[model samples]
Target chain A: MNTKAFEKLNYTLSLLSAANGDKHHGCIINSLHQVTASYPAKFTVTVNKDHETYQAIKASGSFSVTLLAADCPEGLIDCFGYRSGRVKDKFAEYAVKTDGMGNPYLMEHMVARISCKVVDSLDIGSYMLLVGEVTESEVLGDGPVLTLQEFTNRGKTTPPAATVYRTMAGNGFRCTVCGYIYEGESLPADYVCPICRAPASKFVKQD
Target chain B: MNTKAFEKLNYTLSLLSAANGDKHHGCIINSLHQVTASYPAKFTVTVNKDHETYQAIKASGSFSVTLLAADCPEGLIDCFGYRSGRVKDKFAEYAVKTDGMGNPYLMEHMVARISCKVVDSLDIGSYMLLVGEVTESEVLGDGPVLTLQEFTNRGKTTPPAATVYRTMAGNGFRCTVCGYIYEGESLPADYVCPICRAPASKFVKQD
Candidate 1:
């Protein structure tokens, strides 16, 4: 699975946060899915175990999803991207509020906010498939939501250290059902017994 | 689902490409996997129905995976990130070559290359899971590979319009065993037979 493959899928940059003090803290990530009809929208995300964001998600059963706007302030992107929430209280630096359902929403710029309750989780080699229900929802503004292309066109930068690691491992097949790593010959014909062996019907590529 | 949910799972990012004649198009994608024990490793990638890169992948039959260095050139990133293979030959801008198995590889700054043969494809809504057999593999450099964090940190931008669409449609889960949404809500112990009456054990998430 290569970044190019993931790139082909359209997605939005979002931040998932859990209630913290009078606000919420979380990590910025991307998604190309809509689970609205399915009360609890099942989703998959990659979190470095060492990051504060990952710790926050594990501790809190609830998280907030703020759909980033294409026109969001560069400072906002930097606040979330260039800096880590572990060392500094990022929420304190900006206007924040706990949503009606206790989730946090940045008062800065965004398109929508969805508060979710954790439903299930899948442990991949290093990441987790976090399944949650959309407990609360809010639409902020109109117009197209910010996209990966928009984020990149804005000249955003990738974290230096992470970039290197992604390059070394190379891209490969990802188990859509369990987020497992299948770095081998085209998934076994049966493709049903590698890990959970849910069956060939359950896998999706990271691309 | 939102990007916040997806970010919790830390995954790596890499480049995937398919060569045809003098033209080669690439895409930036993620991989939820670990390297294999075999020298000629194998892997798979998901190709979307809407991406220009998917066409190149189908036409070429084989693709190359390039691991971008931590401090890779932005120009290099944009060449693959912003441009569409549908309109131009992206490889024309870079030095490239076909490996022993015939997959394309960037001439400079890549950590390795893995050539795969398409084995099977599973359609899940708008995207297709491209299962490929690893026919050839090579390691080009020794360093940390890039994770999703590094790609995001480098401030890689995205196509806002396409991204938003992807958000409304990707990384969604549908139970493979039973084709249910798995929304955290418990099914009545006696609940049975709406789609398939396989019982609770059969329901799986669409990862």
Candidate 2:
């Protein structure tokens, strides 16, 4: 299989935490996830060690998975994406609430929410795969679910420091055309036959 | 680790998906996944061969994951959650596009789009784990990415037909709360529990 094509489909899902009533209110978590069961719904979201959501789920025992819609305002993603809950009041500006299970959620920005109980967790090196069972759910409104493409097209870019660190620390390389980080940087640079390799020139430092 | 709690969590999650998607889509999948840095930013999605997504992923070697926001509108989750793509165009009414690779994305619907190439697949009983690498990525806008609570509350009033199926199937003795099919179609009045030992009043019928 073409690895490049595979990477293209993986989504950088934004995980929302319920308003924790702390200085570090609602934070954004970028997780790599896959739905395990649609009926008796189950999903596995892998959270990296560096992300705050990982700690939240570990401490709280459960978290919510809200799917972002395409029409969602740019500021929502920006505020949650760029600002760290550690320093900024992530939920200070938004209307958020707690769910039946006590998990926090952004009431206005999401299309759906699933409140889950942590059933199992596995340690996969730098990340932890937390398997959750859906106990409750809600579908707020309807619009197109956001695609990674649309999210990238927006002028908002990851801070240079984070981008560069993610590029070098991870296997992805910076895209020359767009600043997308192709997670295949570990491959030999000389090998270039099947796909277009973003030369080192294309990369810019990520924040 | 409390296996029972995990089981409960898993059971509840399956129920939520059922309520949202319903059985019209067939069996649901359950599994955990993680994104790893080997090359191409590989991630894994576990699915059941008996489910619709599993079949689609196997047939197409690709599938799109729409992260539903906590505030998702009505009928949106049902649109993607309930219907089977094999029988219909999941994105017929919506605008969508394929990335540098062949993975299809909903144009501006998602927070980000990830086109994946199925590098390897693993089978675990009823589920198939699809592992792929992230080739292309685009961030559209930002917000508090969607969580599960938002989804559950999005369609809170919807009947729990799917939930019934989740519990019955995951545990023993056809747990009606989740809808596991019982062994004896016409259970005796004094029938005892096979899975959770719940009373007969809890069992409900999907058929």
Candidate 3:
């Protein structure tokens, strides 16, 4: 696989966030696009079906997209992206505000916050494509949005796992959703990932 | 409407190109994403239903995505993005090469080129969602990919009109796909947009 070639396809990364009452969930997403030019502006967001943010948006029919800036703190990604909403309240750890519609958007290190209402959705095998119309939008900061290339160049390899962070921890399983390494003698049936809260079914044995 | 907010959501843009035999088409698309992690890698690209590239991909069941670089020539965008395949052969004007499958991939200032075969599709009102599995991917150059913010800051406003080049002609109808302004008497019913090759029906009168 031409892994480096794939990295060259730089894309703007964002935090797809949604809230169902006090339950706020957010996840890092690389696939999003503006579908129309204002006048009930539309946008499309694609997410892995197993992701907690996907479940939150599906239940609420509303979500907020916070465009992460180049200067965004690493802690923000660790809290909202590395940790799952099912086990942790990401908003509690960060300074954020809820819109009138109840979606919590990050207040720090973000360039803009756009609120949306889902008008339609499509199911692809492992992901769901949500089509939504922008209800409200606001500029939060003047910093440039972060691109995948910049993120990679900054030595921040997020997702499935950061190759540099692990030290071959003795044939353990890694969480596919949050990249949490679990070291154990045998896979337990009732075990759930501590970092992303994904079930045992979502863990893949380390090579 | 917070117009400036949209600018904050800077995304990397690319030209989606496809060919069936000698019949080729390419169009500008901002919405594309990797659906799965490698191994018969999957991707989804959303394109307007009216776009010629959409018909070409639907017919050929294959396509190529070229990640335009920061230094990509303006003529490339003007030719592929601004013009349609129905009016003329865009590939004829540029120096391009074909892959093993005979798909035309731009050899110019592109960061990477990915070839895919369409696996599934969905209708999303104004656009079609094409799901394709990556067959091949190669890095064309080490140049940085172009993002929407950089393109805007470079003063390259792609459509409706180029903000820097135009003299603001009075009461002109602009091609919706490409920003070519027709400055003349009542638009002829048979008039086709020279820039984008869109019909008179696709023109929207300037405000």
Candidate 4:
């Protein structure tokens, strides 16, 4: 198989956010799609089971999706894509608004925001495909939406500082499932990944 | 709902194809996503149940996906998208190749091709989300993948001739579910959409 061919399949990057009580979590995801165009249009999002946002959606049964704009900064991608919400408050640094369903969604550098209620879910081993029915939607801007290929191109110029530093430190154990890095001397045998909830055995020490 | 906002959320266009015995069919779809990055990568494609390609996949349990390149001609999209494979042999005019499973995939104006077997599926009203486990993949070219926005922009310059003629004739009826237009003088009570299988009741007579 030509593994590199998969990279040519461009996906639009979006911010997926959910709330459980007063706690809100957001993550960057590229696996969002509108499955149907009928009334109460249906959507599907694939989230890693270990993500805090995934847990939030499971507990709240709702989530908001914001399609990133072409001008979205690399820093926002870093904060939402690379960092784990278990240790940091992603919304603290960004302007956010609650959708009609009470789920938090980003308010800047996005082309559109859609609120959805989880109707059903399918488990695909490490990931869960959440089928959601659109509860509310808004077109926020006219800017072109960002694609994963464009994001990768931007990173080629200057990689995310946090990711670069963590990888260079050589003290990080990366979660093989979700790419979450745990920095320490050695991973605890019973440690579970805060991001994807994978066991310590699923991590490989950074080289 | 700001319905116009949905227009800004660009999606990558893909050609979904499948075969059952000696018959082959293909359709254009945008709701395709890579849900997992494991050894046998997983993907999810939402296909309208009425589509001939969807039925072919259901019968054969496998399909091929080709990501359209930026330079892909509008005529190809018009043929694979607006026309029904149930009445026309879509592969007749195009060069094609079969995968390990004997599913035909497009060979031109595409950036990549992936062959997958349906591992699971979820029903969401009029659409079925087919979870595919990659059996083989190949990068066909280095060109950028096409996006729905780009296609729309191209269409604005010149609408598909078949669609324009059908709509202008005033004798056509459009499937409310999948936008498949049926050209005829009158609707038959027992008629079911050849594209989406929606009954005559689901068709709206063009004004």
TM-score of each: 0.43, 0.47, 0.85, 0.84
What range of 10 consecutive residues in model 4 chain A has the weakest lDDT sum? A157-166
Q: Put down candidate 1 lDDT per residue, B25-140, tens digits, no spaces.
A: 67666532222212223344654455556676778776666666555666776666555565556677677788665656784766656667765554433444455556665666
lDDT of 4 by residue, A148-171 (tens): 778778663211111111223557
Going through the candidates in order, state the TM-score of chain A alone for each one: 0.68, 0.67, 0.81, 0.81
Q: Give DockQ: model 2.
A: 0.08
Q: How much does candidate 3 score in TM-score?
A: 0.85
Best by lDDT: 4
For residue B154, model 4's alpha carbon misses the true position, in angstroms, by 1.0
What ranking of all candidate models by lDDT puts the best one first? 4, 3, 1, 2
Q: Please provide, for model 3 over B59-82, each residue's C-alpha lDDT reduced to its tens digit, 9 standing for 90 to 100.
A: 788889888888987887777766
- Model 3 ranges off by over 4 Å: A37-39, A159-173, A181-192, A205-207, B38-40, B159-174, B177-191, B205-207
lDDT per residue for candidate 4 within B1-207, as digits (tens), equals 765655666677888999978888988887667776544578888777767888899999999999999999878887787777756898899888899998999879999998999999998876788898889989988889987778778653211111111224467877854576688888899999875466899887776
lDDT of 3 at B30: 60
lDDT of 1: 0.52
Cα deviation of A206 in candidate 2 (Å)?
Answer: 10
Top candidate (TM-score): 3
- The complex in candidate 3 yields a DockQ of 0.41
Model 4 has a clash total of: 4
Candidate 1 per-residue C-alpha lDDT over A152-175 given as tens digits, one digit per residue, 9 for 90 to 100: 655754321121122225545654
What tier of docking accuracy does candidate 4 attain?
Answer: acceptable
Clashes of each: 64, 125, 2, 4
